[model samples]
Target: MDSIPVDFQWLGGAAFAIAIAVLAAWSKVFGKKEGPPAPKVQEFYASGQLADMGPVKELVESVGLVMQQMVRTNIALEETSKGIHHLVQAYEKHLAEEQRDREIAEEVARQLKDKR
Candidate 1:
């Protein structure tokens, strides 16, 4: 018995062609049948009743309120930072004045000791 070598490319092409032919025949025998017509958009709104957009309006108003709150919070934080900066400046000034007073007192003590 002699076995012939088969080329994979030719075999794949023949298999694909047979599969396509079978699918075509199957669809011709049991294809989808046409049903009733789909309803049109005009039919849904034929009674002149508009779609309710109350939820959309409420969402926009809520977003506006959140933005306003964010602005107010930013302003408050800026004021707080400014107040902290002023407090640090005042504390530095107080320390400088206290050092100057201590130096003046030390000079006076030195002068009195030298006179004695």
Candidate 2:
């Protein structure tokens, strides 16, 4: 017995197209509905204009003062680091000078002993 050959590529394309069409129809029927129009920015702010914001304002001012103090402290810390670096450099220079003096004294003693 001989059987007819089926075209699987055409069948697959038709199945994919039907799946996409069903998904589109389902989304249109069951997806979220549009919400109300958003309020305008000016209107939104105007609605809350009568609310008291004194505490919020004072808190912001206190934060500003703290930030200023932090900036000053950072500047002082940088200056301290610079001063420490200078002190380190000076100590190193003093040590180098002492080493050179010791070397010179040793060389002089060696020459005098050779001459004697």
Candidate 3:
């Protein structure tokens, strides 16, 4: 195998240097021309309208709160129903006791009248 010719080696080095120079100049002139700077983190939080969700988020949050309140109210109503059932049972027991007492009194009175 023959060694590379000296002239060809020089030409190759020149071509590589020229390619590097052209690429650097092209990038300086046209590659991604600088636009406005990006917003800093704090500035993004402070200034952008997108960060402020206005009434839409509030409405959603209020709806969530209302749903929770409705659930609570339903639970309270269920408890109230249970309490009313207990009260009704208590009243029924009292009425049954009173009815038994009246029957006993009537039986005693009838027996007393027969003896007289």
TM-score of each: 0.52, 0.59, 0.55
What is every candidate's alpha-carbon RMSD to the true fold?
7.5, 8.0, 10.8
Two-way TM-score contest, 1 vs 3, winner: 3
Sorted by lDDT, highest first, which candidate order results? Answer: 3, 2, 1
Which stretches in model 3 have alpha-carbon errors above 4 Å? Answer: 1-52
Count clashing residue pairs in model 2. 0
CA lDDT, every model vs. true structure: 0.89, 0.90, 0.91
Which runs of model 1 end up more than 4 angstroms from their true locations?
A: 1-52
- Evaluated at residue 61, the lDDT of candidate 1 is 100
List runs of model 2 lying over 4 Å from the truth.
1-32, 36-51
lDDT of 2 by residue, 42-110 (tens): 653577854567787899999999999999999999999999999999999999999999999999999
Of 1 and 2, the candidate ranking higher by TM-score: 2
- Model 3 per-residue lDDT tens digits across residues 1-116: 98769869988888999999999999988887778999766554566765577677899999999999999999999999999999999999999999999999999999999999
Clashing residue pairs found in predicted model 3: none
Among all windows of 10 consecutive residues in model 2, the one with the lowest summed lDDT is 1-10
**Model 3 TM-score, all chains together:** 0.55
Give the winner by lDDT: 1 or 2: 2
